[model samples]
Target: MDLYIFCRMVLQQKALILLVTVVVAALASAYAFLVRPEYQVSSVLRPAAINELDALNRSEIYQLPSGDALIKVGASLESYETRLGFFRANQKLFKNFERPGRTLEQSFEEFNYNSIKLVVPDAKNAGSLNAYIKLVMNYPEGVAGVAILNGFVQYAIESQRQQIAADMEVIVRNRLSELAGRLDSARSSYVTDKAAKIAKLTEEDNLKRAQLQDELKALRAQLKNQRADQIAQLNEAIGIAKSLGIQKPSTPSSLGGAGVQGSQPVMRTEVNNQQIPLYFMGVDALLAERAALLQRKSDDFTEARIAQIAKELQLLQANREVEVLNQRKNEDLFLSGVQPLRAEEVRLRNLNVDMSGLKLVTIDKKAIDPLGPVKPKKMLLIIIGIVFGLMLGLVAAFVRGTDQSRRENSSDTTLLPHSSIPAKKALLSNVEAL
Candidate 1:
């Protein structure tokens, strides 16, 4: 293993080494020319950054911008699923193209391991949120190789755009669906509450109307009795005047309760702790006139007093009905503001329109056919072969020399049979002389 001894052995076997080196050189030349070479084409792409997606995400569904999402998209372009999709989509193209085997699956696998490659830059090291994607493809030397990369460029760009757009739309729809459900619940609650309040108001108004009607009938009866009593009083006064032949009664007669009724006070209602008063001035005036007419006994006075009493009762009944309706009107709140929520529903529905047509990625550079083949390094291979061949030659020489020395030491005769004994001895003598 020492340098001097090894050098001596190699020099002694220089002829064998030269032959092996020449043979290796010829083989390497053949390989360089005969083996098929591969041509590579590459395309650069710019993926949508998280910020870019966020800008397009009007629904605010995505949590944040993610460089990793872009990176994954790039990586998926090289995946089996995506490649299979390309193959299936371009079945006509694949049918006409050269394949390694009969099945499309075989051809697809060949393209997967050997032809297609992805070079996605690490976003973490790039000091940028978005990293660019590069795709490299190596194909067997032919025009088809160029076409393959060209087609792939389109497939990748289109697929990535579609993928990103679809993802965004899905997220938007999910967010919209949640919002829609919540809005529906709120609307339902509003509608139910409005209906309940309206029903309660109607019932309360009905009760108030019934109570007012009962009170009006009672007032009518009281007024009828008063009218009958007043008519009798007027008749009695007339009888006294006729019998005594006097123009006026000698005794000043009490007008019963007509004076008390003349001071007509309006009723006041209590609403939410506030008192609201309703006045009946017409009833007060009519009662005062009736009382003055009742003091006389003439025919005209009797007729006028009865007419005034009837008019006062009618006005009182009408005023009571108005008070009942006014109370119902004052307690309305729910139905007055019911349109705003409905308008919001309309707005949200319109906000959920189509957003599927957005573009998420753009192609920066397309794949182009390389001017020359990318593989088969002729000079480098030739150098390696020459070195390997010389080592083989040296090893062969050492083995042959060792076999010869063993034969000479172990055998009493020459290494050849007895017929070559003289020649073998002559060869040994020549070596000794040298």
Candidate 2:
């Protein structure tokens, strides 16, 4: 339609349009003020600082980095079970949500699905490590939005903290058990080796003692035979000296010079270049050596080897290594490898930390009561209502004006005079006028 005609139609129903606009606008205003509105309360969390996680990271048994801590906190916050648990624990805070038709679980589901939201850094972005996570709660008015938000945040953090502590405890306990097993194995191995070595030493000493005994016995027998042979030779020499009537030791030269008394004392040549025989030593010296040989008791001193064997046998009787090993009171002290394992065990045992105090996340912005409700944009709603009312009123006015004009035309036709003419001619005339 042309602007003039459209304006005329609108002005014709100005009162109706005004009333409709006022009613719609007033309804929107009332709804905005009277109905319960939802407020948005949020808390911003970031990864903990290096210093804040120092206690957990410094531990040898377990380590939790800042990024990992943040991830864990976020996971706990986003977990459905965790949110449901929180809702169940603090039902009083959500009492307004519960009514006759809605069950507690349904309310919690609505609350979890709609009211609560977790905003995290986009995974598509690479540098999201330093990004903070936002936990938002859209709670109705007078529902303690601030407390619910803060309380859930604290609950999620505490839940994650307990999980970490449980994990750390399990890790430390398993490690300690492993170390204990290793230590026991090492000690057992050490004892086994020591016992084997002692047994080997004892066996070797016994074998060596047997060998020395055999050698000693052989040497003593040899010395006894030599003494007996010496005695026999001395006795033979004594008999020879008695037959020759030589009681004292005599050189060969003296024998030649005194030969046969009356024989010619002519120049007798005496050449003694060879060693003298045992019989030439004389009957008295032979008899004395034979008597000394017969009186001898132990022949151990006769041979130098026998004395050496005796001394070695005495040494073998007391092996110093075996003695030291057997005399040890604490074998653990002697285990070299077991020391490091024990030290590690001690270190782990001393790391019995209280993770309750450990901080996981840093709160960048704490949840607080919002200044105004986020829902029910009053101005926008009021404007929409007015526009809708105006459009409806305009359509109604246009239909009414069209119907009035049609009625007036119908009445004008009825009042006009009726004249009879050729049907074809009248039809043509009417057609031409059209």
Candidate 3:
């Protein structure tokens, strides 16, 4: 009830309190010194750019590169199978460092699945590569813990490297093959287009040349007509000279001069009266005939005029021939179609064959030994044990005190029956207070 009374009661049961305190203290000390200490060795391993164009290399046309791949690496390192296999692979080391009361396989399994922890640090920034992979290994031995964590990290990195390389090689090879196929097919089509264009242009040229030939023939016929006229005029002039009793001219050889049109007039009589006038036809017949003679004229062009016409005709024929030749040459130069474009497309496709790259990349942080054990804080446990021992000892003392008080009251009731009521009431109050 009061401090002094409680102290007096505890003093009466000092032996029991002291025994409980000693037992609790001894148990605490045993636990502090005997249990094996546990250490937590932690390390970080984040994915780093493996190449200069790591982002470009890993990216595809429509896909986002996954930082989750790095997370997978971290997770695989803490898997039960991986840890168990690692322990089994190094049996002697595992036996030496593994925790007690479990087989090596079981011990490593628990260590990986239960004790080891994974953390994605800075997870709020998961949209990018802001997250870091944190791996923690909890074990009884600090050096072994660090070694095991490092080993797992190496395995994970290698696995990621292999996976990335294989995948990228497949993609690149497929893309390269596709490019080659397209370029080859395009080039073949280009060749075919070129041949077709050449054929078309040649056909058009041949047709044009044929038309030119026809034009030349017609122009030549026009030139021939002019020549024939010139020849005929030369013959007519020679015949006229012969009729005048002049010596025959030398045989005509060239038709270089112009053409002449000749019109001859014949004699005709016009009767004026029934009697012929003596003055008109009498012995002065010569004079009368002269008066009656009709003026005979020929309708003929001058040589100069014929020559001018011939030259103009010749000029027109030459101009037509020249124009036809020019048209054929111009139309045959190039095809206005798909061949040129196909050739250019082939060139562009060929240019894409040169770009290539490597695929997998990795970087890691090494695991380091922990500064001290993580568990079994000896100084802290000793302090806790002191407080625990005091409380337990006080509880034992109170229980002993209550039992002793009840025994004393029972003995008083038996020895003095008349004062039992008052004594029992006082006893009840004392028990209540206790």
Candidate 4:
């Protein structure tokens, strides 16, 4: 175990050490040159600007903030489903992962799980205002990493935009349908109210007409009775005038009782009164009044109130309120609440949020061609190979040295008993040759 002796022993096996080092170094170099290297390609994404989302935010129906858009894009980037979909769509870009035993599905799974990565700010710096997402892909040779990154980003954004559009469409349709339903309900209510008003007017008119007719009949009956009484009183006066032999309408003072057969002499006196009695009027005038009263057809014309009641009944035959309601050209004008709802519906229907060029997230940095592969550091590998070869060569040299020393000792021990000077000299010579 002396350092000088071990050095000599190692030098004795210098050819073996040289052969082992050269072989190991050559194998490392071959492997380094032959294995495919993976290159790193990445893109950075940031939240969109306010101006970019202005069109979508202008309407009250829906609102989307820039931060939310960034979150959605980031989530899409991190989704396994999204990566798998991208892999399936761009299989040609990932054909290099395919091998004899691996099916396309397995290769895609490997690529999706291992190759693609989303780099986000750590929890400590996650809440920073400058939050971003970095999409990284380590691709093998023959694959277009930059193209895949760019295409996947575009695809994700487009997918999110389409989803937003579809959601807006559903919202508009539902709102419009709800508005339409309200309009229908309002129309029905308006119609029902109108019909009820008409019915009410009709009932009032009928009742008024019936009351007017009853009043007219009562007035006519009263007038007819008065006429009959007047005629009966006139006949009685005529009889009395015949008995007294009065032949003309005359004042009571003008009447003289110059009758024969036990009649007393009459005394005349003047009396002033506004009305004269029917009996006091002469037989000829009374008879004429009675004849006229008996020949009368209707008593309605005699009373002024009867004429007024008839006119009212004629007017009530047609309800002017009902006529106006039925003749209305624009019934919607009356529904004050409905018009505002209609206006709102029209505004909503006219709303247009154009998302043709909608950009959800800003691409701070797009993927570009890498200058070189990130893995398989050639110089590092060569250095490691050289170190490993030197260590193995030392181990082999130590083993050979130990075995040669043990054999020299054993041969000396076994040959010493019968050894001559010549044998001893020969053994010494053999040891020197070794």
Candidate 5:
């Protein structure tokens, strides 16, 4: 019933009970001692700053995302880890541990794969501070299991930084190159256009010169025709005078005096007169008139032609001047438009160079080694062992108590008391003999 009574009964049969208890307890302790200890190692890491986002913000490219902090952090971490060769290194770890069932490499791989934990501390401290705390906790020697975890974390961070720098450099170089190429193309096009414009202007100038020459030629031909007409008229007048036999009047004074004495001055007639003297005089007068008209027309035509030619030449010169000015203006515009682009390209190139230098100088923080074992906490293991041993001892005691009770009950049932027995038949027979 009581523990003392039960223990006493077992002690009375102490040899067997002791033997069973010793065997059971020994086996349990042995099993507990033989069991492998599991160690827990942990390291903390915070996501790296997103340089791209920073750049975008600084450049005022676009609006930032809403309060999706987790998504943003995850995306940033993933991008950062990828740059750092996290997956590649993980694959390598997996490959190295390849074996039939189990191996050290496999163990290590499991530790790496399973040991990582990501947590956001609080809403108040979001990016930088949270990352910092995570970094501190993950430091190699600072916390349990942190040392082993720190190596991978360091590798991941360094790898990420290197990758980011590389990507940035490549992007900057490509962009600068594209800008440079575009600037060069623009300059070339501008030059070609300017050349074409100048050539067109030259062609127009040549055409204008030819037109002026043609006008001059037409004016000269018109003058020559007028002179020819005047000559023909003069010759006709001379021929008519000769046919009329109108000789030159000799002794004009003697003919005039005789003619004056009469009512009408006697017409001084030539010996070879073909028509009346008045007709000859009229023909001569007509010739003179024709000559005068021709001379006047020639003079007027020449003056008008000269004035027109001069005005046209002035107009052509003015147009040519305007064309030259236009070409100059276009050239100036081309230079103005292209020069800034070239300068910008140069500036971008220089900035890229500086950025590359800075990237080259950047370095990752070094990892520290742990001074104590990070896993398989001894105190926790001991405490768990003690509790399990106590539980097993109690179970053994309960089972032993039950078995003893059954044995006692069986023995009592097998051995009967003398008070309950019947009187012997021999005693009755003896009484009859007496």
Candidate 6:
């Protein structure tokens, strides 16, 4: 129950307790002495700016540069771990040969697998990994551990870099190709539509020009005909007046005297029952003929010319407005639709190429050889041994004391039943045996 009582019980069976304690302690001490000491060597590597630099060089359209780099790093680590198993197997060189009965292979296997602790520290405590890596690489012994670790790290980094390069190149190239295809299609459509529009506008412009020319020519002919008719009519009126015996006033005084004389007959020429005054009739007919010519010129010549000119001008204006509108539409489409799309296509193509390049990148040394064994910490082993020995000693003491108590209780029980019978026989037997 209590420690004191337990100790007293063990003391009562001191011989057996002492024997068991000695055996357990000796066995535990021997085990601790025979076990090999192990040292830990680790290394750390920070994700470099190599991926970012590569992306910048390749293209401006990076979707996830940082995420890509992290993914590459993780994949590289996985590959390294998988490939380094063979290197870990070679840790037998570090095994101590002081124990001839144990092979280095057997001892090394025990140390390598269960003992080694390869840790990747958190970002905040990443310095620890770096320190560990440096220690392993720089370990004094020219052992397989260091060689393997160096090889693994070098190969892994190189492989990862190559793969990233290849991937970047592929991605950029593919994107560019896709963009090029789209641009080609757009260019073809634009060329086709432009040709059609140009043809239509040219035809309309030619027709308007022809119509204006025809209308102008007809107006000129009409004007010439009206002028000829007016001239003929004027000449005839002058002749008729001459034939009717009408005297022309030679002087302003004569004309005024004629107008004042009441007895002067109003000289009239009658034609087709229409009386024409001999004095003013010729002048009136000439004025009417001139007005008719002027009216014909205004109607057929001047007005036709103005109307044709206005129509032609309107067509020209429409054509110019259409050209201007088409030009603006073309420019807007180029800037808003085509140019940006083309630029994007080019950008994506470049990025794809970059990603392809990254994919081809390879680590020169994926893993490094650990310079020292990464197992069986010596002080820890010794401390563990001591603890094991104490526990075994206590257990041995308890077992020995429990066996001793059983023997004592059996002896007391047998003696209690035999005590009365043995008392009567004790006197006779004591006398006879004496």
How well does candidate 3 match the true structure in TM-score terms? 0.55
Compute the lDDT for candidate 2: 0.83
Better of 1 and 4 by lDDT: 4
Regions of model 4 farther than 4 Å from truth:
1-15, 98-104, 240-276, 417-434
lDDT of 3 by residue, 55-80 (tens): 54334421213354566566567566
Task: Give the alpha carbon lDDT tens digit for every residue of 1-434 in model 6.
Answer: 45776888667766655565566556656655565534444445444455545655546544445334544555565553533443354445454321567665555454445433444445676452232222132222334454555555555556666655666667667767777777778778766776788778888887877777777767667668767775676667656656643344232333335556576566544334554433335555565666667656345434546575766757675577456646664443553367777768655643344232343222222344444454444456556655665666667777767676666654554555555766645644543332
Q: What TM-score, computed on C-alpha atoms, does each candidate reach?
A: 0.60, 0.87, 0.55, 0.85, 0.55, 0.47
lDDT of 1 by residue, 212-238 (tens): 566655656666677767656555555
> How far in Å is the alpha carbon of 426 misplaced in model 3?
4.1
| Residue clash pairs of candidate 2 | none
Give the root-mean-square deviation of each candidate in angstroms. 13.3, 4.0, 13.9, 5.5, 11.0, 11.0
Candidate 4 residue lDDT tens string, 1-434: 36888799789988878878887887888888889988999999998889998878887777889988988888888777777787788888777878889887898888887787888887686764758989999988888889988999988888788778888888888989998999888888999999998998898888889888898888888998988887788889889877866677777656543333465665667777767666677778778887888898888778999989978988987788888999999887787487778888898888774566889999999999999998788888888888888778888987898788868765775767554767777776665555
Off by over 4 Å in 3: 45-109, 120-133, 141-143, 205-365, 417-428, 431-434
Among all candidates shown, the one with the greatest TM-score? 2
Worst 10 residues of 5 by lDDT: 354-363
Candidate 4, TM-score vs. the true structure? 0.85
* Model 5 lDDT tens row, 1-434: 46676566555655555555566556555555555533334344333345524443342222233223224433444443442345346554434334578764555455345545444467677664444223322222223343334555545445534554565567667877887778677768877876787677767866986787788777777777867776676567667656754344333333345435546546555454354333244444656766676656344354476677767767666455446645564453545466666766666565532222221111123235445444445556555656655555555655676676666655654465565333323433332232
In angstroms, how far off is 58's CA in candidate 3?
13
lDDT of 3: 0.58
Runs of candidate 1 exceeding 4 Å displacement: 1-13, 47-69, 91-102, 122-124, 167-201, 227-248, 251-359, 362-365, 371-374, 404-434
The CA root-mean-square deviation of candidate 2, after full C-alpha superposition on the true structure, stands at: 4.0
Number of clashing residue pairs, candidate 5: 8
- Pairs that collide in candidate 4 are 249-282
lDDT of 2 by residue, 255-278 (tens): 656646665556656677788777
